[model samples]
Target: MTDRRYTLSKNERLCGKKNIQELFNEGSSFYFFPFKVYYSFNKNKTEGDHCALFTVPKRLFSKAVDRNLLKRKIKEAYRLNKPQFYNIPTSRPINIAYIYTARKMLNYSDIESSMIRCQKKLADNILNAQNDEEKN
Candidate 1:
């Protein structure tokens, strides 16, 4: 059987214009090197079922092929490192957008490393926020 943990299933992809708008409107964000991460908690979603969106702006990559390649790289990185993000203790599901901010193409290894770092940082940020709220 294929390992589900490493797969990026359709349900795991954030879709629909309304959902996208809500994520950008209400989500909190952070920048880590080549990516800008935006995330929000979804109270209605099932546990451990986070959704993510990958974006490569047209302004930076005018060619559709280039944009698609970058997006694929980003998605692969996320799929591989997703289990780490799941380790973060949370009652609600998370919606995330990983917007590629780099002007040029980067090696897959570089993108993967940055993705790992971003995951760790995001986990720490979420834990800190949860702790802060609990104490207040």
Candidate 2:
């Protein structure tokens, strides 16, 4: 049986042009291999909320099928690994964008491993920021 918590629901999908623009403009970003991650901490949101955007640019992947396939793989990797990523206690939601930067295709295992590493780094950053805020 599949766990419902692992499912990527509509509420967890980042949407709206305003929200996307805000994330890119104000978010802190880091690159981890095939992905460039942009993340913004949302003070307006309640605790333990997070939303993610997965984008495989049309410029890199000319075909719709290729872009969709890559997006699917990335989303699956994230959905499975997200529980660990959210273990940090925070007062607000996180808005994250995972932009695919690789030119060549990668297998699922490769993507999943990268996702795990990326999540660790992201958690570190979030903790650091939280500590900084508390110190201030």
- Best candidate, TM-score: 2
TM-score of each: 0.92, 0.94
lDDT of 1 by residue, 1-136 (tens): 1234688999899989988999999998999989999998875675657899999999999999999999999999999989877877886788899999999999999999999999998888888878887899
Task: Summarize candidate 2's per-residue lDDT along 30-75 as a digit string, tens digits.
Answer: 9999899999897567764599999998889899999999889999
**What's the residue-level lDDT of 61 in candidate 2?**
88
Candidate 2: RMSD over Cα atoms? 2.5
TM-score of 2: 0.94
Judge candidate 2 against the unseen true structure and give its global Cα lDDT, from 0 to 1: 0.89
Model 1 spans > 4 angstroms off: 1-4, 46-48
Candidate 1 deviation (Cα RMSD): 2.3
Candidate 1 residue 116 C-alpha distance from true site, Å: 0.4
